[model samples]
Target: MKQGIHPDYHPVVFMDTTTGFKFLSGSTKSSQETVEWEDGNSYPLIRMEITSDSHPFYTGRQKFTQADGRVDRFNKKYGFTNKD
Candidate 1:
């Protein structure tokens, strides 16, 4: 642990731009914007385009494409039928 060698880790508010969700977390990143947290304290506000709150995967809103196996695709493409 060298002095003045590590970046400052402090509490910051991460905001999800899409959902307007905010959460307090420690980060090395800094921002000029600030926000008042629920704890009656002000912290740096970091705006994010996507977070767990709004991400499709995390929210279970992700759309999955139907996929066919290689064999099935080949058979469908060439009009091949299984003999067995």
Candidate 2:
């Protein structure tokens, strides 16, 4: 590990804008905003548009489309059967 060459890694808060969910994590990114965490310590605040808390997939609001495969659809359309 080289010294003075690595980016500064520090604790920061990531907040989901939509859900207002916040979590503490380490990041090299910096911001002018600051927040006091539950641990009674202040860390840099980073605002995010989306996170696991508000994401459709993570929130169980994601839609799964079961589309037929191209080959299967083509075979079915032409009435083709596998000989093997």
For TM-score, the strongest prediction is: 1
Task: Give lDDT tens digits, candidate 1, residues 1-84.
Answer: 789999999999999987899999999999999999999999999999989997778998853432346668889899999799
> In candidate 1, which residue pairs get closer than 3 Å at backbone N, Cα or C atoms, i.e. clash?
none
Q: Mind giving the per-residue lDDT tens digits that candidate 2 earns over 8-84?
A: 99999999987799999999999999999999999999999989997778888853332346668888999998999
What is the C-alpha local distance difference test score of candidate 1?
0.90
Q: What TM-score against the true fold does each predicted structure earn?
A: 0.71, 0.69
| Residue 47 displacement in candidate 1 (angstroms) | 0.3
Error of 1 at 62 (Å): 2.9
lDDT of each: 0.90, 0.88
When summed lDDT is taken over every stretch of 10 residues in candidate 1, the lowest stretch is: 62-71
